[model samples]
Target: EQKKNITYVLNGTTQIQSYVKQLIDVTKSWNCSDVTYTTVRLEDFFADIKEQALGLVEIYHQKIDWKAEQSDKKVTIAYDPMFRAVMNVIQNAVEHTKENGIIYIDAKEQDGRLTFIVEDSGSGFTKEALLHGTEQFFMDDTSRNGEAHYGMGLFFAKTVAEKYGGGIKLSNSENTGGARVEIFFLSSQETS
Candidate 1:
């Protein structure tokens, strides 16, 4: 079946604004902690992924690589939402994985669509959880260990993906005992 047109302008605009505000608040609170904010570039984002992985290693003495596989096709998306989508995926991977766990990212274009896959080597979720993963405030109490996750990350990411005539899917990771979140972006022609 063709993907549904999931764009809701009012809802999307509100979510995007809220997410941007949260990101800005967090960055401002860092003050002078060597945190750098710049236009989101693929390379720079990957660098931050590496840095976060290294910090996780330091804390848990684990080693993992957070690298996105190379692809020939390049698509320029809105910087803010794309960055937030990627950051949310990375944050989820870090939060859910145990020490020494691995997270893998792969990007490619297939069948006229660009795809990004984020997978982690953590405990996998139940089928029910996967089904409802994109619902706002629909956190699985069993999965969330009393953490203060807003549970809106995937919801907003899915919103942004749909706004771009794309789609997002959550499933069990085939390589790891963790979840895999895939974001798909349809070409402009497809949208037209």
Candidate 2:
């Protein structure tokens, strides 16, 4: 009789623990999905502000060691959520840049579409790093002066750009030997 009661209590406790673990796993997956969605929206909105700030810095030349150029037509798009995506790229550049490093923001129309470029005077990625850089949560093994980098910036940036019917490209600058991130946006009429 006592043995039977003990067995019942043990089984109940085991079942409860199993249920709790399953709930936690589901919650984590949902949180990841939410973060991805929110980050995409934020990026779309921030891209414009980034362009504007770069423009103002070019015109004033006050604290403007960097140079940015944009097309005259001013291709505009409705950005739903604008914070995370844009900031990730900008923050990466700022983090890698040395004091007085030159950053360039340029926009141009090519093949009837608009493209935005962010170039920074910082150590560019190596071939191996660049190849795998877009993977989620990929951090470069090389550290520069103890700088903290999680390696998720480019991944998130690319995600946001694609969500808005655009894409991101990464390369090294031939002129400045720095890093360049080009965002390509097709006109609404063009097929993705």
Model 2 lDDT tens row, 1-192:
999999999988886675565344334433434433221222333355566556544443422233333333333443322234444565666666676567666645556444667677778767866687766656677743256455566776676567556778888888668777877555432232
Please count the clashing residue pairs in each candidate, in the order shown: 0, 7
Instruction: Compute the lDDT of residue 14 as modeled in candidate 2.
Output: 82
lDDT of 1 by residue, 111-184 (tens): 64556788877777677778898877677877833454656777767766776568888898878878889886
For candidate 2, list the clashing residue pairs, or say none. 41-81, 42-81, 42-82, 42-83, 43-85, 45-82, 46-82
Best by lDDT: 1
**Model 1 TM-score on a 0 to 1 scale:** 0.64
**Residue 95 displacement in candidate 1 (angstroms):** 0.6
Q: Which regions of candidate 1 are displaced past 4 Å?
A: 1-74, 110-112, 144-146, 187-192
